[model samples]
Target: MSGLRRKLLIITVLLAAVMELIDTTIVNVALSHMSGNLGATLEDTTWVITSYAIANVIIIPLTSFLTTKLGRRNYYIGSIILFVVCSFMCGSSTTIWTLVFFRFLQGLGGGALLSVSQAVIFELFPKEKQGVASAIFGIGVFIGPTIGPTMGGIITENYSWPLIFYINIPIGIMAATSCYFLLTEPVIKTKVQNVDWTGIALLAIGIGSLQTVLERGQTEDWFATGYITLLTVTAIIALTAFILWELHIEHPVVNLRVFKSKTLSVAAILTFITGIGMFTSIFLTPVIAQRLLGFTPTQTGLLLLPGAIIAILGLMVSGKLLQRGVSPLIIITAGFFCFIFFNWNMFRMDLDTSAYTITLNLIFRALGMAFLTVPLTMLAISSLAPKDIPQGASLNNMMRQLGGSFGISIVNTYSARRVASHRVDLISHITNNNPLTIDRINSYTAYFMLKGIAWDNARLKAMGMIDAAVVKQSTLLSYTDAYFMIGILFAVTLPLLLFVVGGPKITAPKVIVSDH
Candidate 1:
């Protein structure tokens, strides 16, 4: 490939990957708009998010096999077309279920974009420059989700929510066109092996059940609900069967054997933790700002922009250091500390905190993520044979997604329990015997009575108001407790860095091959 052609291919892949990732978080701000427009309850409308996530997790680990089965170039172009068409359908839908269906289809197409893009980027670079390749790829992975809500807020505010999905049409078409003209299938041919129908079935059952349970567990009140209980059992049975089937199969869909590599094992574990920390923090910060501190969607999005910029700078610096022979372990250590610092700062957040305080803390968070992401990317694929890179990347990526699901579920459950606990504690302090409590209630009742409310009603309203105040305080305390929990998660993981082996010390490989 000529320099110009290579650059174009690289650009195409990166843009496609960014488009997919951006869509993942973009709809977050538009949920309320969607609810009103479609006349669906907030609970039902949440399926819009859950459906897409379920589709994404199911399709991600299947990419490596799917790519080889369909030609790489063909698969890439097809996925883009699927995404574009689904984007149009998603925008044109009149009903909520229609939109959810289209979003799920879009996710099926979008899932491959990230994993395939990572493989292509890695393939484009020589082995010794894998670290640099990871850095380049890291920028898209990190920035896309960060910028997604911002873009969605701008579009939804300036225009409408449908435009958010519609916007992907033109970009997707262009990317597909570029892939057709510029991207090439590897010359090395893979054997036309039997399709692992059983494996695919197991994967779909396992991952789909798992995602549904996680996404709906809180809404359904966990295992107390029959549906949640059923899904949980299904997930366990399907996932266990999937593992056993994959390990025994001649041509496994996901190639579970890749875990045999010690480096890959450690990298996958770390990637899981990184996913938990990254997604959990992202999930919490915006809710904290909007629900507690009263930030607009745009304001919340902009608050994290500075952190994204800092993260980009960290990526560039880390890339340079890796090129100059800095050990991966040291960089990872620095990244771990950066993550811990950000989480620790989050613990200090309160209702009255300023935007600048959160922004500065997020900068450290972004910097920490930049450090872990690139090096872990290197660590995951570094020891694998060239042909196994896709499988390895798929597995790692899937684990990361699962980690995010797990983290979100765990945090939600913890916050709910903590809120109840704190509420009880706070209510105990509001007894009639307490002088301050009595005075506060009396003052509120007097104000209500003066506003033309009957005395009896005013006293009842005052008590209700106090109850609400207690709930709000408890909620804030629960958020703080969750932040501390995340901080401890990162802090504990920092020491595990000593165990990860560094990548090989060598110059760039002269030739690269991709097995299609």
Candidate 2:
């Protein structure tokens, strides 16, 4: 392949990957608009996001099987076409159900975009330039979600909510068309195996249920809801059965055999830990800024932009270090320490803190992630054979998403509990007999009276204001506690790094022969 064409293919696929990734978080900011426009309750409109996530989690591990059954080029192009069409359908839907259905389809298509796009990118580069290849791909994986809210906010504020879905139409079409003409199929040979229909069903039920429990657990109050409890049981049973079933079968929808590799095994563990931090930070920081610091969605996204650029630079620099023979282990360890620092700094943030200060802390996170993302991903499949890399890659991708799901669930549950606990601890000190409490209540009463309220009304209003203040301060304390806990969580996982040993980076021969 010519250098120019190869770069174009890379760009084409990266665009598609970013588009898919962006959709995962883009709808978060537009939920209110969607609820109003679709004539649905806010609670019902959450399906727009949850349905998509369910589809993504279910289809992801199955990509290797699908790619093999369908040719790589065919599967890639078809997924793009599906994604583009689904985007149009999603945008045009009037009801929440219609939108959710199309979003689910979009998720199905989007999973392939992520799992297979990286496979193609890896195959395109030579063994020697794999680091550079990973650097480019890592940008989309790490930055796409960060940018989505920014883009969504800009569009939502200026245009209608549907535009969020419509925006993907052109980009998806461009990527699909380009891949059809420019992308070559990588020639990985394997014998035709019988379809594991039973395995497929088990996996879908298991992973789909698991994702639902995670996505809705907090909303439904965890195991309290009947369905949540049922789904939890189903997920555990189905997943255990799926694992046993796959190991026993001649053909499995998702090949668990990939985990047999020590390198991949260790790398997957590291990737999971990394995913928790990577995703939880993205989830927490945005909420903290908007909810506590009073930044708009657009402002929150912009706050992340500088850190993102630093991350890109970090990715490039780390990739170069790998090419120049720096030990990946050393780079990864340094990244963890940097990440720890970022989390620690975030833990210190208060309502009075400036955006600039937070931005500086986030830059540390970006740089650390850049160092970690490529190296861990490269390590995951480095020791696998050419043919197994696809399965390896898919498994690693699935783990990252799984880790993200777990991270979001954990953070939400923890923050909510902390806020409630803090509120109780704070409110307990308030009593009619306490001198400071009485004086504070009097001050609020005097202020309310100045607003022309009756004495009794002012006193009532004063107590209400005190309650609001308590909630606000407790909320802030909860977020800070989450941040501090995040740093500690990542730090505790540092011992897992010991299992990661050096290996020759896997590089496939020219599996892709140019058709032209």
Candidate 3:
């Protein structure tokens, strides 16, 4: 393929990938609008997000099998068409359930956009330049979710909620039309005569149920909810059975044997850990800005923009360093420390902190992730046999997605518990016998009295104000605690870097071929 066509194909795939990823978080800020417009409760509207996530987790690991069975070009183009159709349906739906159903369908297609697109990008470049490919793809991966909230906020605030879903249509159509003409089928195809029906069933049930549990667990109070308990048991059983069945068969759907490569295994684990930090920070920062700092959705999104741009520079610089023979292990180690520093700085944030301070801390986060994303991609599949690369890539991507889910769940539950604990401890010090507490209440009462309230009523309002203050302060403390937990998690995982040996000579990806 010529340079121009290669660049066009890369841009086409990256656009599609970014569109899919952006959809994952774009609906978040619009949940209230969706709830009001659809005549549903806030919780019901959230299924729009949860349903899509469940579909993504289930379908991601199956892409390698689907691509082989359907052919790469056919599968890629088909998925894009499906995604576009679903986006239109999602936007046009008048009912909540209808929208959720189509969002789930969109996710099924979105999974291939990520896994297959990564494979295609890798195939576009030569063996020695795979790091550049990873860097290029990393831009889409990192920036897609980073800017999603910003775009969603802008669209939702200025227009309507449907615009978020509608926006995907034009981009998806463009990518599909481009790929249909430029993308080619793999010349050497592996035909599957006997489909792994059992593996597919178990995988869907296991991953789908697990993802749902993670998405809804904190909202439903974890295992205390009956369905959460049932789903947890079902997930454990189904996943264990799926692993055993896959390993026992001659041709498995997911190819569990790929884990035998030590480098791939270590890389997968590290990716999982990285996903925890990468996603949890994105999840936490916006909430802190909007809930405590009095920032609007657009302001919060704008706070992240500078860091997102800096992240692009970080990605390119790290990619060049890799091309110039800087060890991935060294790059990855540096990424960990950068991330640790980001967490530490964020942990020091208080209610009085300014947006500029938070933005600076987030820039460190962007740099850490930029350094990590490309190097990790290069490391994961570098040692794999060319034939196993797709399966390896699929598994690696799935791990990252799962890690994000787990991280969000853990932090959500932890923050809630800490808030309750902190609130209780704070309230205990507000007894009548405490002079400072009495004086604080008196000052509040005087402030209310100055507004012309009677003494008795002013005292009551003062006590209510104290309660509100306790809850607010507790929440703030919990957020800082959450940041510290994220930092400590990274600090503890640093030793895993020691286990990463250098990957072997890299081979070009075998999954894609250009029809020039």
Query: Would you list the C-alpha lDDT of every candidate in the order shown?
Result: 0.83, 0.83, 0.85
Q: Give residue 252's lDDT in candidate 3 (0 to 100).
A: 94
Total backbone collisions for each predicted model: 0, 0, 0
Point out the worst 10-residue segment of candidate 3 by lDDT: 506-515
Q: Write the per-residue lDDT of candidate 1 for residues 108-160, one digit (tens) a residue.
A: 99988989999998888776567667877888888887787778777877789
Error of 3 at 409 (Å): 1.8
| TM per prediction | 0.93, 0.92, 0.93
Worst 10 residues of 2 by lDDT: 507-516
Candidate 3 residue-wise lDDT, 1-516, digit = tens: 677788899899999989988887777667767888999986678678677777877888899999999899999999999999999999999999999999999999999999999988877776666766777788888999888878887887788888898888889989999999899975446777689999999999998788778767877988899999999999999999999999999989999999998888988999999988987888788778877887777887788789899998888778777666677778889899999999999889889999999999999999999888887887788888777888898899888877876776678778888999999999999899999989999999999999999999999999999998898889988988998998999899998877774565322222223333
For residue 398, model 1's alpha carbon misses the true position, in angstroms, by 1.5
Residue by residue across 11-122, what tens digits does model 2's lDDT show?
Answer: 8988899999899878766776788888998667867866776787778889998988887789998999999999999999999999999999999999999989898888
Error of 2 at 311 (Å): 0.8
> Clashes in model 1: which pairs?
none
Relative to the true structure, candidate 1 reaches a TM of 0.93
In lDDT terms, which candidate is top?
3
